[model samples]
Target chain A: MQSSIKQWQDWIGGIAAQGKFVGTNRLGFEGKTLKPNQVISDGPYAEVKEMVGGYLLVKADGIDDAMKLAEACPILQIGGHVEVRNVIPMSR
Target chain B: MNEKTLIQQLFKSEYRKIVSVLCKLFGAHHIETAEDIANDTFLLASETWGVKGLPENPTAWLYTVAKNKTKDYFKRRHIFSGKIVSELKYSQLNSESFEMDLSEENSKDSQLKMIFVLCNPLNPTESQIALALRILCGFGIDEIAVAFLTNKETINKRLFRAKEKMRMANIEMELPNSSEIHSRLETVLSTLYLLFNEGYHSSSQHSPLRKELCLEAMRLNYFLIENEATNQPMVNALMALMCFHASRFEARINAFGQAILYDEQDRTLWDEELIAKGNYFLIESAKGNEISKYHIEASIAYWHCTATAHNGKWEHILQLYNQLLQIEYSPITALNRTYALSKVQGNERAIEEAMKLQLNENHFYHCLLGKLHSEQNPKKAMECYEKALILATSSSDKRTIQNHLKKLR
Candidate 1:
């Protein structure tokens, strides 16, 4: 499950290269989340209770591919879950 | 195809709809929460949708997701103890609930009411208008900052303060009463006009004019007109005035986006349709006995629009300006009137009248003085140009004045 979760993370990181990811928490995060292609840095001192445990990023194909990718993610072993969603483009 | 385009498109359409819906479901007091939830829903969609191949009914899907998100928000906030939350929960099951209608109207009304609330004279000077343009008009902080000639951080601070005041005042999202409507309406109109002016004459280097800002302002004015209680003649007159001015937008600049003087512009490129619409509004505005400043301004624009090569009637424009001055005294109007007077009665009288008035030490006033003095006294013109260059806020304006000074030299 850990390896699968890592695979899911790798899939997301890969998809994110071609897509976008948005993060939100009921609790405020230290600094803003990085944009797509922005390198993440360390040492903001994340609160143990408020750390982001999972993420999602859109890719081509469909949710089937998304879920298939998520199935391999490492988080599920540690009780973390990934939810795949499709974004609806805004109408002009 | 790309994530950026997708996100942009989503924001363009669903951003308002989702925000409006969420704002209604939540109370006016929890608007910030509602906005956050709406934004979160979009972010979620952006992350998930690329792999999902998009939804069949994206808007409906978003609405459902937002609704669920709002419920989660309430749960997290522990707001379910209130009778309002119980009522919302009870009505949630009934798909055709009256709450839906009320909520829909409430959202739009909240935005409209916010415009007035932000523009309240008791608030920070001109900052509320800037705030409303940012929030209500959907303008970016950078855009608002540029419009007001302030830094983004300053604009952000002003917006924060304005919002804090609203929260402290516990301002309800209710429309003003008839007696209070006129005063509130003035603020709303001014905010819209400010937004339109920013778009009409943007100082940004990359894009000189942001037409989107103008269109958004006009859209808000249309919304104002739709409200039965708010549809005063002055509102109509203002709308007409904007339409008339916006009609000439295409002809206002050349391909290079340099400022095209009125006399130099090609009249053929002006949008006749917009002019006609403006005239229609102007005629509608005259139905009542009271004439507003908008009526006078629209009439002046109409005169300019209808002028032909054989008869570019400056007298009619001057008359409108005279009527405008009687209604409201502003230095900007005086400056404009002086220019028309120069065209009709000649430069000496125009210069004499302009010289008497004490304008706020601004670059435009000095530039006008420089132009007025250029023909008669090159030395004086040079001095005026130097003052204008010193005071100029925009690089383009400064460059133009510098060129004028160079010519004089």
Candidate 2:
């Protein structure tokens, strides 16, 4: 656990050094999910086998640049994969 | 044997001999030097043997190559011109200084001493095992890394740190003195036992690497039993324990890699040869007055091998467990004993002891609880099985627990 967090720090710090780091959040195991009709339950992937461990936000010139950052992610070391996507900003 | 097999065998057997002989001659501080010479010798042997076919006497050829390499090492390091210059006159120097006499007795002495040196109580147990694997077992760093389920960098760092610790201690590559032999021997035996169990008790028990680990531990233990000074009854007893466990290696795991319970296993799969060997060692171990924990555990393992599920077997095992707890009381042992207790006495009695253990975090404890509760309380047994399923992280273990739960339903 400590190693992975240290890995995350190095990864994020690498992007930050390149002026591409925007933000990130390590989604913890504990959370709550509010369903329809005010029914409360466990968060997110409680029933699903797959989980979104965390998310990284980065600024890139294009999808190709963002894909490069995703390819360098440490999660890939243990058979985990990363999905790179461009965020659509909502205009107010 | 074929050329490749011959090289492989020599690598496994002679690599340790050459390294140990070099370290003994040059002192333990030059362990890396010894290892380097040995590694180079093997690489050369493989390349040479691949083209030329097996030599008439491969061991002798390897020794000759190693001796020359040792002389070259001294020459390259300029030790003749530097440190030993005054002591080494031109007339006094000869090939005797570079002779790699890996005679059976000589290599055995070096290796036996090497085990004691590596098991120096000053160093941590992990370091001791890692160093023993590299120095004594001739395992490559990548092989050790895979055996340990870690990366190469981590293993490299561990070996580097361990060698540094040994250097700081300046431990001699020899047997401990009489005053300290007992404690030192105990450390050596325990380290070997841990190495064996690391393979035997691993969740991935079916892996060939795990079995290889067990055999390496046995091979080292064999060295101890061969030597006169270290051939105590405890050593033989530990050997017997391993032999008995390994005899059932085939039967313990099915084709699908799931564990087969003792009663459920095919009796034909148990190796008769290993059982006989275990009996021989058990008899050998009986000569001494000492009744170590190894003695008790070996006897317990023997009963498991010799007989099927029956009162006489469990009764003997249960009695041994009682004595084992007296000698060394571990929670896992206590939990293990409950299964035999359940067999000989009854579920109620075993359940009483199991409840006292309160091994809340252990899946095996709940597995036992499920077994104990099955006949009388199916619902409780199902609950226990569910708890075990939740607690077990291994897919094989989870599958086994689910099977038990399915039966209860």
Candidate 3:
């Protein structure tokens, strides 16, 4: 598992060398789950399939192009998947 | 060259100019749009040039494509007649024909403005260097990371923070007034100097050295000399310094990417043409009364460019080092002075001076001590070399210290 993680890092590093990398973030396990009013808890709960590990931002042309990039990500090899989103830029 | 290689070269040389001009035409807020259009122009060139067998004037071809694409964008979005018309000159707007003038003078002005904008005081020192490398020099993040001896992450963060600040402040893409040029010019020159030094003494193991960065720095400095406001004695001094340093690039690195110390470098391999240019600039730098640290450093470099152990060379170098230390008392300069002193006075006196400097933690300090102690005190020299070897981070620097240790054995 450690070796595979190293491999994943190398793959991401390769993309970075090409100057296409934007950035990434690391998520905390104790993310707050908020509801209406004063209801807040540490229960986005690992039981659900909707938990996010993190996000990797990159420069790509379109949805299909970004999808292609995500396909090379190593998360899927460990039973994890990627979710790509388009960030709508706000007007200045 | 192959079509792809030619296109890539053009992209490196002309990309920044096009982006700068476009960013000026449009506002600073639309810099991303300008970058996108420029990238598209390059992409189109890459796609079509292979089939068309290359254009006679590739740079002109790129400008034409960018202008036409920009015109099309304005027509399609309907913002040109409303937004851009107000920002641009009324004569240009009313003609119904908008031209992106990319004449040499305009391109030079845009690049000069970019240098000032990148070196704005709002940005931190590191961010200013990173922005200049990216915006004016057309360097990729990877190249910049290698140049600075840091990772891509750090360079990325610096660039992002700088761009964000630029956006918030809405820094104009135009030259500063004459009153503000002196202080701003100092920052610009220092940034260029750092860029040149990175190329001259690069820590990257793969490429080891980057002559391209050095050349780019010199090329930009030449632009300052061309303009009246920026043509100061210090600018000429910096140019002379770069030329002198660049003249010996061919002899500085070996085939195995090992650094060859200055004394051991092949004098014949040094570029005579560049040395002559350095001499010219050094003389030109003597015009004004101002004697900057650059002038003193350039004088030292000029002595080195002679590449001969003439009668008074070491004495002259020591004098210049003394002057430089008086002006800017950096440990690095002091470390260098000990060597020149060793030549002028004696090894024992030089060693005494070296030991007085509180640079015990610096690898180069120990390395110099190791050299000083080699003949008289072999055991002390061995210990100094060992310390240097342990402290050195880069493989090349470690290898250099290791070589000294090997000689002692």
Candidate 4:
């Protein structure tokens, strides 16, 4: 049931070789949760029992292409999912 | 079992139950098929229970599924026709109805007999031990390998040969006839006794795989007690002895995984409940006039558990050991008796008896001699410790001897 680190590395290496690598960031647990009346709690998302394994960004042609790319990620093989979001550029 | 360990513990127990019953129904030659059905049942449980949680009566749920699977197996392949019992003749007779008996009573009967079936005397003792560990205890090949300190291929080969022997003998999973019952039961009990001893005094104490091996042996022995034909006096004595030994299991090992000698173990860690169980079974064992070596050994164990200063505990233990050696003479048992001899008759006489055995290659022999001389003769104790330190195999034992040497200095 354990997906090894080598598997993750190999999959990521394949994507990087294809020149579609964008960026990645691990979630910093040192954050706050702001409630309805601005009451904040100093912890990670308290409600999520399923752990979030941080995020990876990838360059793609379109949303469908990005979806296709996301579908090939190793996370999907191990019962994990990928959310394909558009990173709109801030043009000056 | 709680939700965390519910599946595992159920698998350990229910796997054997279902397999035993299936082995009886499907015949010993189809043992693999029986195992496959049990495995599939567990696989289904792991998937379903993970999603829906455990059923109210999980064992019943498993039994119901196993029954259905057996029914499906019968339907898929016509395993038994009316003419021949085991033909595997496929047919298109959908109208032919089948009934399976997966009742609790049948399951108990099946398992009680399965122990003897696995420990068939035709097979070598090693093969019997391997088969018993595999079928009865639900131990994996890898686990059995770890237990035996061997590789998987060797274990697999032994299992194959043992199964071949079973097939050759045309063995069926049932109790022996009244004429053969005594001898057959002796083989079964001896296998269980060796299994328990393997767990207690294994070469690799820290392996952790043997952590439950002793309990598994006791559990298998318990099935014999539950059955009428197999519930002889010797069975209760063995169970009593196991209970007595198990009661001190926790006290025998310290936080550092070092073995604590009987004298040094904290009395508070002794399990009162298990001692009570041992007492009950000892009483049960004494009902018959047949005094097995197990009975005498259990009496000695009882003395160890309930010893007071003025109670002549060592004397009674020494007497019991003498009785045990008379019933069954083994070098190891006689070696153990000398420890009691030292306690009862002082060091000099015990040392003489211990040396007569001439177990020069055995580290325990030298270790015992070292203990006997530690008070009166430091030079002799040092020499014995040196021999023990070199001859000892396990690190824990070496450490124990090292401690003795430290004191002797």
Candidate 5:
């Protein structure tokens, strides 16, 4: 599963290398990571399991390229699945 | 887009969707654990993707992380007992089929069921609806606190107590039986009405109109309409009333975020489409011989919406209020009917009925009495206004009554 996710990440990273992707990670686990603008806290016996696993965002030319990149995701090797959805464009 | 804004937007849309999808995979009973894992997955995604640059399909990447997190949680939970581990493995296979069956329609149905479960009468009155709105509808405690005219600490306590009751009762996620549906539907309708009214009469200066609350109420009402057991006349009537009131939301408040009296509101600003929809629902609600308080209230509001002028027909409104009073003679109804009487039969008759009732010494009742007395005896009106000001909950309401007193002065 880890390899599948890694492969998928590499595929996505390759896309980014080609200037076809932009990535971001949403920090969901509150105390796990020190957020860019957040202050660090002292030890409160933090739980490792509660830590955030992080994410990747990729912008592609079309759905096909996105799928092709997702096919190599390391998560599938560890018996996990990926969910693909189109982002709705914001009207500015 | 900038990295921070892009990440924020992506997380906002995907977080709920991913959590919802995973909850089904890991039984609804294990929702808290599922939520924790989903949170962990997003954190993982943030770290990995931020430095590596975004993946081709960000949603897919997040899902992958979430699924792995789910597996880890199950594995840990089953670590103590071998028998539980085997059972977990069995369920893991079953979950694959479950994931395949998770259609859009099913998800919506699940959400609707969650709403009902939250509003269950078996739960404590104080926090049942509030907790449900928070968990099921994503409303924050602060938002609910403002709506209920209370502080966040009280709201939080209520929510905590509610969740404890749910856990103690071992409340399962399922629809109520046909026999119990009516009572359950009553609770559901009340919650939805409460939600809509908060949006319709918002107290917040920052966001005077919460369209989210209105839309959620409408959506839940639609869900009720879809279900055979809940499709009653009262439900339809309440929905119609919500639509009619929501239609006038745009004109209900001024640009400065101050309350705009119905008389001063611009009728042209109303959403005609929603009014037409409300009219259609009102007709549907009136099909049967039975009449509910909702039916009467909706009918009254419908007339107000259709009236060509502000003072078009107080007699019709008075008649509807009389019907409403017969069906449900609450203090609020008495107060409202008094206002309609003041409009139609003159201040004397209105004052006579208003004085008969023992209102909770609230500002609204005093305000009503103040307005009724203002025409005949300005001194009495001034006295009522002062009483109302003392009882007033908000500065805005006090200011309104003060302005009325100023007219007399």
Candidate 6:
């Protein structure tokens, strides 16, 4: 498992070396979940099968390019998949 | 170590050096631009390294990324072929020059040069110290605010105004000429002294962070002393004074975070290594005929550190304090000298001298009076203690005064 993790890291490092990686944020356990009843509770609900461990902000040309960049993510090896979304910049 | 922690540590240590070099290349007017590039480089490191793991040559990697980013900035602004190219005229902007300029020796030179630029005599002392804290020391706006007992907005405005002056004046980031060196060096030393005092008597609720401030001040002063051109007697004396004070940092507070009086501090807790360093610097400071206020203060501290007994030690401290008062007359120093006088000349004369000073409003002055009168008259001591308790601002100081009151009761 450690060796495979090492291999996974090398792949990410290759992407980083190209100056494509912008930033990453860890998804913490302590967050709010809103319900239809206007109720709030501790969240990222543990009942869910898969959860966002974190996210990486990578620089790519388009949605397809971004998906391609996320294709080799280590989560895939552990029966998990990634969701890619376009980041919009609000006009100042 | 975790990648995040490593990057943060690197940022702390290398941020100033990288910014210093960039400012040297880009000039003081463009310091903000230099800072932005340096900040972006660290941000990139955090983003990339957080997922990919650590690089083998992290510092070099950082330097390379920062250099590339700075070049990109020049290209984006379209200044490489225009303003920058003509402004720096004979020297062109290229990766080679960037690499050469940010070399180890050049980095040190830039930092030393930045010191003088930040300490420009024309600038307000507050702004000069604030710039030193922000630019030279890599402190955040919030930390600088905390140090200055002000809000972040005020500190931000102070830094902005300081930078604006540098821009308007087009200040050069280099050592002052020989004639100005004496005055310039004095400004630098006093700024460092203020910085160290901020750390030692830090306003922070957290005790340990205050020590970090003191250590930061010492680190900067040590840099000045290391360079041959700046290593004068006064600088060494200042360093010796800082070291001596720093040696007692651990003993200055108790487990409860209360200020421990000097007489009550556990001498065993004093850092012997720092004391030895202080002694070495003190010996080095004696090389020239010049004796600064720092010289007298450091000697008094040295005697305080070495003397195991109260016997015959007060005479030496009293003499140094006398010399220091002759050279520089601060009310606090006068109060301290009066306290020293009580040891050698008895309480009556010390009280007579202390009462003449114009420090009635100061809690410490009342506290000293309380001590001086405690041995002679209990009623007078209680009155002084009550006055001190009312005037005291820090909760810890009030607690100490109350303790004295309780003992009397």
TM-scores, in order shown? 0.71, 0.77, 0.76, 0.75, 0.70, 0.79
Q: Which whole-number lDDT from 0 to 100 does residue B122 have in model 6?
A: 71
- Number of the top TM-score candidate: 6
Whole-model lDDT, candidate 5?
0.68
DockQ, computed on Cα atoms, for candidate 2:
0.01
Query: True interface contacts reproduced by each model, as a fraction?
Result: 0.00, 0.00, 0.00, 0.00, 0.00, 0.00
Cα error of candidate 3 at position B1, Å: 3.1
**lDDT (Cα) of model 6:** 0.81
Question: Taking the tens digit of each residue's C-alpha lDDT, what string does model 3 give over A1-92?
Answer: 75565445534543343334577676777777787998887767745767788787776778886786677678888888889898877985
**lDDT at B29 for candidate 2?**
66
Tell me the tens digit of each residue's lDDT in model 2 across B1-409: 7878887777878888888877777667677888888888888888998888888999899998998888887788877445543333243445445456688888888888888888777778877888888777877788888777778899899888887887787767778887888778899999999889878877654378788889999989988898888888999999999999999988988887778987788989998999999999999999979999999999999998876566588767766776676456566777767787788769997787577565788898899999999999989998888888889998888988988988888
lDDT of every predicted structure (CA atoms) = 0.69, 0.80, 0.81, 0.79, 0.68, 0.81
Q: TM-score (chain A) of candidate 2?
A: 0.84
Task: Tell me which of candidates 3 and 5 scores higher on TM-score.
Answer: 3
Q: Roughly what TM-score does model 5 have, to 2 decimal places?
A: 0.70
Stretches of candidate 2 above 4 Å error?
A1-92, B51-53, B80-97, B309-311
Q: Candidate 4 — which residues are off by over 4 angstroms?
A: A1-92, B1-4, B48-57, B78-96, B206-208
Q: Which ten residues in a row have the lowest lDDT in candidate 3 chain B?
A: B88-97
Among all windows of 10 consecutive residues in model 6 chain B, the one with the lowest summed lDDT is: B92-101
How large is the i-RMS for each model, in angstroms? 28.2, 24.8, 19.8, 32.9, 31.3, 29.1
Residues B237-341, model 3: lDDT tens digits: 999999999999889888987889988899999999999999999999999899998999999999988757787898778767765654555767777877887
Could you tell which candidate, 1 or 2, scores higher by lDDT? 2
| CAPRI tier for the interface of model 5 | incorrect
Candidate 5 lDDT, B1-409, residue by residue in tens? 6555655555545554555555443334445665577568767877877788888877677766776666666557664134333333235453223232235676565655666667878765547657655665555568778767789999988876776676677665667787987778888888777777776766665454277677767877877887776788888999899888988888977787777778878999988998898998999898778787788888888888884746546767766766565444466666777787678768997787577455747789898888999888989999998999999988678778888889999
